[model samples]
Target: MGVDIGGTKILAAVVTPQGEILAREKRATVAEEGPEAVISRLIGAIEAALSLAGTEPARLAAIGIAVAGMALPGEGVVAFSPNLRGWRDVPLRDIVARQLGVSTFLINDASAAALGEHCYGAGRGVNNLVYVTVGTGIGGGVIIDGKLYCGACGVAGEVGHMTIDVDGPRCNCGNFGCLEALASGTAVAREAKRHVAEGAETCLPQLVGGELEMITAETVFQAAQKGDPLALEIIAQAASYLGIGLANLVNLFNPELIIVGGGLAHMGNMLLSPALRVIRERAFEVPAQAVRLVTAQLGGSSGVLGAVAFALQQEAEVRP
Candidate 1:
């Protein structure tokens, strides 16, 4: 069993060792009800999957959880999650393990996604690879020697927080010039709103009825598809920044492949083309040419499947 506890939703799954979802369920996190209520929702989701799969409690070996936060291994506490509001140091692993009566563990969602990709997606057969998710925010995870890599403090591949410009827009991470500040979904919305405020003519204003508050990444993507120059410019700028950050990763890790996932990646070659062009231009030719970058195969389900695979790997380690 595995769960991906997202800010607004929970995805629960019974998965096999190969990252296949035998059964799965998704439900709202309802986090506004606080930690206890959120826990109940998580359990409900798991029970739903179990019911769907006809699996008994004793049949389950272990449970894995993937969450987004600044978490330390063996701590089971959510240090901080901007997406999950009013949360700090919540004892998540203890709560789940106590309620479910199973061996349980939690991992960062990005790392879990990386594991999923490495085991079942573009990273298959590669000992070294990276997973880059460009969604509401930019996140990354690293795999080395056929295993997930967690940094010394466990928040290893927080590539989104890397500073690219010292005086750029302020980021929610309380930092200026972070790559995410310039390239995340929030950045796209901000850029679109600014352009609208400047009286730029586009279908976005009409689509949102002239309310800049209605500006969003989805709307910007739509506008770009409609050939709105301003929206296209914003996306291009974001792609450029993404390329710069990827160039850094390529130089540092020399991974065999880099898998791009999340909503922004759905733009397909539109979003990937510029970033790929920039990464190739900036990174050293030897390693750059060797590294293959592609979009992720599994969609939203990757995190939960990866978490399950992680638990299975742990179980195998303890046996024999």
Candidate 2:
């Protein structure tokens, strides 16, 4: 069993040892309802998936939870989560374990996605790689020498928080000029709305039927697809920032590949092509030449699949 708890949705799945999902369930996060309500929804999703698969909780080997926050898997606690306003020091693993009467483990959502990609997706057979998800916010995970490097304290892979522009917009983490603040889906929407507010000569406002608040990153992408100059400019700027961040990662990790995933990945060449150009221009010749950047193969299920991988790995580590 595996569960991915994100800001807007909870995904739970019953996956086979070979990384194939047998059944899955999804629920809206409705985080504004608070942590307790969110946890209740998460549990409900898991039970729904189990029922769909016709399997009992006790019949599962183990359960892994991918949380969108600073999760300390060693302590089974969610240290902090920007997505859920009131989640702090929440012992989620223990609560789920007790509720379901099964072993449960906690992992950072992006970190679990990295593990999933490494074991079953684009990073398969690659010893070193990075998995970056560009959605409501940017999140990342690093795999070094075939092992997930969670750092000394298990909160290591925060590639999005890396400050690229010293004077850029404020990030959700309360920092300035983070990659996420500049290049994520939220960033894209914010940039689009700002342009529309300034009366930019674009069809963005019309795309959202003059409701500026209804403008989203997808709306911007749609306008860009129609050759809207302002929309194209916004996407270009965001992709450039993303490329700079990826270049920094290339120079730092020198990994063989970087798997770009999440909602923005759907933009395909429009997002990656420009970012690749930036990476090649900014990174050192050897590292940039040696790296291959690609989109994630697993789509929306990556986090849950990663949780499944983590559960299997953890179970193996404790076997007699």
Candidate 3:
């Protein structure tokens, strides 16, 4: 069993040993309702997935959870989650394990996704790779020598928090000018809103039906697709920042591949082309020439699939 706990949704799946999903279930996270409520929902989703797969809890090998935060895998605690309101030092893994009577393991969502991609998606057969997910915020998973590196603190893949500009806008992590604060979907929408607020001559106001609050990164992309000058400018700026961030990763890791995924990845070449251009222009020639950037093949399924991969990896490590 594999569960992905996001800010707004809980997705559970029954995955085969061969990395195929047999059944899946999804439920609202309702994170605002507090930890107990969110835990209940996660359990419910797991049960629903099990039922759909016609498998009993006792028959399952283990359950792996992918959480969007700093998860202390050794302690079974989710130390903190920016997206999940009110979560602090929560013993999520133990709680789920006790309730379901199944061995449970916790992994950072991005790390799990990286494992998933390496095992079954874009990074398959690649020895070294970096997976960057750009969504509401940015996150990353690093693979070195074909192994996932969680750093000394298990918070290793926090590529989003990398300081891009020391004097740029403040990020939720209290950092100024982080790559995430500049290039994430949230950042894109924020910049677009600023432009609209300044009375930039764009159709964004009309597109959102005069409600600035409804403006989103997707809206900006839509307008940019239609040649809206302001929208294009916003996307270009964000893409440039993303390129710089990725270039930094390339220089640091010198990975053979970089898999770009997340909600923002749906923009495809519209987002990647500009970023690639910047990477080529700025990154070191040797690493830049050796690296190939590609979109993630697993899409939204990456998290749950990654959870399964984590569970399987744990099982292997414990054997003998």
Report lDDT per candidate: 0.85, 0.94, 0.92
User: What's the C-alpha lDDT at position 55 in model 3?
Assistant: 92
All candidates: TM-score = 0.96, 0.97, 0.98
Stretches of candidate 3 exceeding 4 Å from the true structure: none
Worst 10 residues of 1 by lDDT: 68-77
In candidate 3, what are the lDDT values of residues 209-270, reduced to their tens digit?
99999999999999998999999999989989999999999999999999999998988888
- For model 2, how does the per-residue alpha-carbon lDDT over 15-124 read when each residue is reduced to its tens digit? 99899999999999999998899999999999999999999998999999999999998999999898887998999999999999999989999999999999889999
lDDT of 1: 0.85
lDDT of 2 at 74: 93
Top lDDT hit: 2
Clashing pairs in 3: none
Error of 3 at 24 (Å): 0.5
Lowest-lDDT window of 10 residues in candidate 2?
Answer: 311-320
What lDDT score goes with residue 71 in model 2?
A: 94
Candidate 1's displacement at residue 96, Å, is 1.4
Candidates arranged by lDDT, highest first = 2, 3, 1
